[model samples]
Target: MNSTRFTPADAAELYGIHNWSSGYFRVSDKGEVEVTPGPGLNAVLPDIVDEIVARGESLPVILRFPQVLAGRVRQLNEAFRTAMREYDYQGRYQGVFPIKVNQRRMVVETIASAGYEYAHGLEAGSKAELALCLAQNLHPDALLCCNGFKDDGFIKLALWGRSLGKNVVITLEKFSELERVLKVARQLGIRPAIGVRFKLNARGSGQWEESGGDQAKFGLNAGELLQVVERLRQEDMLDALVMLHTHIGSQITDIRRIKVAVREATQVYSDLVDEGAQVKYLNVGGGLGVDYDGSKTTFYASANYTLAEYAADVVYTVQEVCKSNEVRQPTIVSESGRALTAHHAVLVVPVIDVTGPTRGLQSIPEAAEDQHQIVKDLEEILANINTRNYREMYNDAVGDKETLHNLFNLGYLTLRDRARGEALFNAILQKLAKLVAGLAYVPDELEDLPKVLADKYICNFSLFQSLPDNWAIQALFPVTPLDRLDERPTRQGTLVDITCDSDGKIEKFIDLRDVKATLPLHDPGTRPYYLGIFLMGAYQDVLGSAHNLFGKVNEAHVTARPGGKHLVELFVRGQKARRLIESMGYEEDMLRGSIRAQVDRARAAGRLDDTQTVELEEDYGEELLGYTYLEYEE
Candidate 1:
């Protein structure tokens, strides 16, 4: 009998998640986590996961749900289209996927394929990314936005794209860039549509607030913008200036700030049009945020408004400004990379262990005769009367702890006595705090203490390699165990990655006080604990590095079929030892041969027996085929 009670097979039947897909987590009929099945298993997850594991894959792997990506594209398009229609907005809304967010070929291809209907396009910030966008063979009508600082090569590539009949818009970040674009366009004999990135006086709120305002690195100031227009006019290339672009920042939280930024940009559009700049589009650079916490409240990395609300605001605000200026409504373009891609991928990691507070005395032992009075005082405090006396009792217990510490320091008590006193005092305080919590009068610091004391699960995944934004900028992503969503999570624990670096631990978590310094995880013993880090599809992939040589995790794409069956396809396996070695500039074949020669020499010298040699060779072979480190299993 298969000892696995819940498998990926079960997850597919219930959760509607399919393999080869990159989004949704397939929950089993019995409420378990697994890859959604493919057509072979009627697209059930348990069978897929079992098959993969049978092939020697591990428990912790990333399952990509492609349907989620398709769905997100559809949702975004429908939202903007609806807003445009409802408001009778004259200009259409077009979206572009920023390449800097995620440059993976599969991800970009998927977005390009799914977004064909909406004239959705790709945005590139670098030459390589521009090449990828150009190679995508995007829909003929789609816009191809080229951003970031430009060199001769980058401008040449954009102009070349235009020569191929691609709707390439080269956004000028600096005034000098226009000179380069002109040079490139003239050489290529292709007048590519030009866009000027305007640095606005308005500032947005959140982590990316600096992406706008006076200090913003990108975009031209008012004087620079005027100079660019004059230069373009002098060269008779003014008509090529078709788009006015401005990006306040990524993950903008406040809707009001966006309104301000848009209003200001809209006025700029009017001013440019009034000056005969021939502006046809207002490209609001990507700032759409994700609701990582599910709180629906604005956070540093989240937006205050929904997609519909955001689209409506942009359309209405732009229309009002355009009507007032008597200029035709310009087409609205948004490089909303985060909101579009954030929900498309989920990073699933497994819990390896649960750590607890260090062991100590439970009650005041018989050794503490001199500190007996202190223990008695703690007990009295623990048996407090009511809220009226709770503060007074807490103060008394604190004083007693200090007195006991002083006694121990003065050599009046032994280490054992001090330990007993500390344990008793802590126990008493815990009890009192629990009582106060019941009455809803617990101190702010003590609010989460009870939960913290309950459990501390140590997960097996690298925070830096997986969620760099969370570690670097304190960006919070939704993290919940892939399995056991049905059961309440009781343990509040900091996640510890496999890296030896001290910074690898995730202590700050999303909470009311702050984004979680740590997360509340379930005990691993009860089940195979796996956590899903959601809304990380954007930026995380490209930004991730092999810190400590921990390469990417095993990845599979999941897709939902029209019928009930789900399709789970293994898109890419995690990095193999050979691949990692090659990346680090070591030839895998040479390294293997050298190691084998060493082993053979050892065996010839009688330093290793035949059995040991065979075992060592087999282990080494396995290492070459598997991920960087052997996942430690308890």
Candidate 2:
């Protein structure tokens, strides 16, 4: 029996649990599969992968555990509920799934269904998103918030939602949007709740710092807020203005910054109520972050506070502010999309190849007549080097290379001499750089040279299709080999995606202090090596493009029961090549006909015999009916 005790760091390394644990995931002794604590992922993963393979799926698959999603929703609601009860706060805490984080059907549906008990809702930013939210969210009491820039069409959708008896809040990002909302509501004969987004001067900390402050793109200014109030009063719609909203940004790492924003936004809520605008809810838009590095430090992609601490801070701050201002404590609503959704999905891909620069050269060899002088000179420098004159000797050796290069170019030395001199010089530099690295005084240029010299692992996934944020925004996702945690990794390599473009490489990685150029992975072998891209459940799916015509990967939804039996359910296979072609504006039948015509032409040209042509045609026809990309095998 294999016995390996994995820490949270190991779980983060294996399953991509960067933040506090929400899902019930555990690794068994042998590490063959990471299972939910009950039935074990060992029983779950093989069944899931086998079912997918039986259906003829390929590598680079995304295994989504809906049980994890359900667990996250329950934890989020429980944290707030526990805080509310413990603090004796007067108002309720309700959470909405920000559809922007992940707009997939299974994810949204699972969150909606699991959160039905807590009245958990969905927040939509666009018309299409609104349609999705309305269709999936069957929770009658859950709030459906319509945010972002609104046009007449968007406002109409919000009003339409209100007519369906759903708790639809149209949050006005700008003063002009208020009139659109009022017009649409009047036309549709539905009184939709109104919320004004406040542009607070307070700023947040982390990658999404631009989400708040006076320079934020969304939200109404002081002047605009007052105008909106006057317009609501004149139109006899002040009663509909029931919610006040503000957002600091996403991935907030500083707890102090969140406290500051909550205080400011709470003051804004108090002022709205004091000015005769009915404000019953405070919507602190999503800023809760995940601790990507698991350090609990203030990094760009992480947070410093625990979920309970964050809830306590928000509730306690709001209660104090409202009490001091002589206003009723408003119900707290949070759209903490990333924190709730970033951990439920994991992308698994295989390492196909590894490459690096050449190695294994000491001093330049003393060859025949031509290269002997260069070798002799190199040996003399190595022998004469002393502690006091080592630096000067190294500099002098560098200058000799330039002189040797000129001599070779002018035909004064043979190519053999030049090669020997170059080899000798590089070997010396490598040794010096290693010594410098050991002394911890490596220059910036030399710091990444070791990684650059290491191999590049060609992974069987597309950066454009699987991890667009890493490619477009230079975002770093935690990547670690799945089954090799017990053994220490020895190879350092960059990850190259399966894209035809040169830019499809993942060289930037998340380190302890900052981003790095390469990751340390295991050496390749006969069996397949797989790496899981962590914390990608939030935004990678819907934002992914079919760049290079690579469509989505196969998806599996696993659920862990209480008794330890894992259930593996295939959600959807990825887009077929024919389906991808149809999506790109080509008719499937037309594409098939064109392929058949080419095969016939090849046969007619005598390039293929009768049997070969028949086999070729059959293969092409089967591929047209099959899924995109070929299956990856060892």
Candidate 3:
């Protein structure tokens, strides 16, 4: 046992739970992770998971908190309102949720309903999203922001939405899109609400910075924007332009960049209003960042500013710019999708097994006189391992391990002998790691001793299907145990998901100060271990691929109940094996016939009897009907 007993606080510190969780989660006294989606609402995550598992649900399930989603919508709206009040701004603030962020029906409906009081609308970046937006029961006054490239059909659909009494603002992505929008509106015999996406000189600071600025694929340059204004004026539709839109980026890490973008957009908006266009809204598209790592610094995974700071800067900067330009302040519009949705979903998986250098090593006996020379050398190294000679022993172990592999390759050592040598080497490395930990100044070669001996936890989830951001963009969502947090974690580990791809592993983890290669974890000897990956409700949900045909994981819609309780109002099972194969161009009936034909051929060749053929056919049918993920006995 460790000299110091672990408490929930220690576990919290170890996992940096507070740093990245954003107060939605906390370590309880019972060592369980508790989620508080709203005030006076609390639910232990493990308890909820247990109840779910009892109902015969599998691991790698998504837990969606509608309260968190609603709370985020309300929080952002209130923040902007408070900032506008404090700054004495003239215009109101209205936000729109971008359906491209999550795009699920439930997520879209939740945000729309939650922000109804604020008249929050939806933004669509594609034709498919535009069609979905047209069907929604959005507030009559809410603005349905039509962004992205548009064709004739896309424009007609958006314009038709206007005929239905929708506040549809079709923001032109490029200068050419305006003609098509106007043409469609003329065909419908209704003047369309128009907006222009302005390409700004100021670029945001983050991975998505290139997606904005003058060189961006979307939006119109200043020169092109001027052309659009002159064209709209000639068409006698200058007053139809109701909004000026600019995108800095998504997940912007610095506050200064946001203020700069706001200044540039406000200047453009004021100029547009002066140019005889009735621009009443300034759209700062989707760049309010979420702090994935809790340091609150300017790191890429975090934001240096708070929600209050973001709101204050945006409202005040626009106010200052508009006042200087001698124009009335426009209604501030923001499409903050990441921060609104990132903390509402979590992926819960189980640690099915653990693999390490010293996991199953048995006690080594004295080296026999007739043992291989490499075996004797390993035994000698382990016997004399001490604080003073630990560094030298580590070096010797590394060299010996190489020689051991060579000897086994040359067929000089048996499997048992190789196992013994490997076990002895791991044991020496463990002792050296302990010695190196206590050293004030360690040699450079020995610094990696701890990491080299770290365990690999085989978690039961597909990284491609469940948590793709970790694999795609090096996204760092918080990973921690669901229970046993009161006890100290003795193992340092990295997670390996159950994907056939060699890249299906999460080695980089978020740290307050730096990126970590391993996470502190408790050992799961004979018990089932569970882990929760937090802050994955944003891009991770819809951006995942069906790589390896793993399909989507199960989903549980966790809604807050009366008296501080929570319940899973909806449960969605994962994809079955049959469906996955069918998607790969294999029909079920055809597959069944083909498989039966193979069985008949085998039996005709005398390879199987009738009884054996029946058993094999039944087994093959069962596999096609089962889940793609591995199953275990309850």
TM-score of each: 0.84, 0.86, 0.96
After superposition on all C-alphas, the RMSD of every candidate to the true structure, in Å, is 6.1, 4.4, 2.0
- Model 1: which ten-residue window has the lowest total lDDT? 13-22
State model 1's lDDT: 0.75
Segments in model 2 whose C-alpha atoms lie over 4 Å from true places: 1-28, 31-56, 358-445, 561-565, 623-627
Across residues 153-180, which tens digit of lDDT does each residue of candidate 2 receive? Answer: 8888888887787889999998888777
Ranking by lDDT: 3, 2, 1
Alpha carbon lDDT of each predicted model: 0.75, 0.77, 0.87
What's model 1's TM-score? Answer: 0.84
After aligning candidate 1 to the native by TM-score, how far in Å is the CA of 461 from where it should be?
0.8
lDDT tens per residue, model 1, 1-634: 1334544454332222342123345555555554322332224444444455666776556666666676778888899899999989988888899888888777888889989988899999999989989988688878999999999999999888987888999999999888888887788888879999999998878877777899999999999999988998998888999999998988788888888999999999999998889989898888887766544566674456888888889889999999999999998999988887777677777677776542223544655545456666665665564567766776777788899889878987678777767766666655654567667456774566554454455666777778888779877766655656445444557777887788787666544334554565556776566667666888888787788878787777877564435555655777776787788898867877988999999999999999999999888888877777446543
How badly does each model clash, as a count of residue pairs?
Answer: 43, 5, 1
Q: Model 3, residue 93: what's the lDDT? A: 95
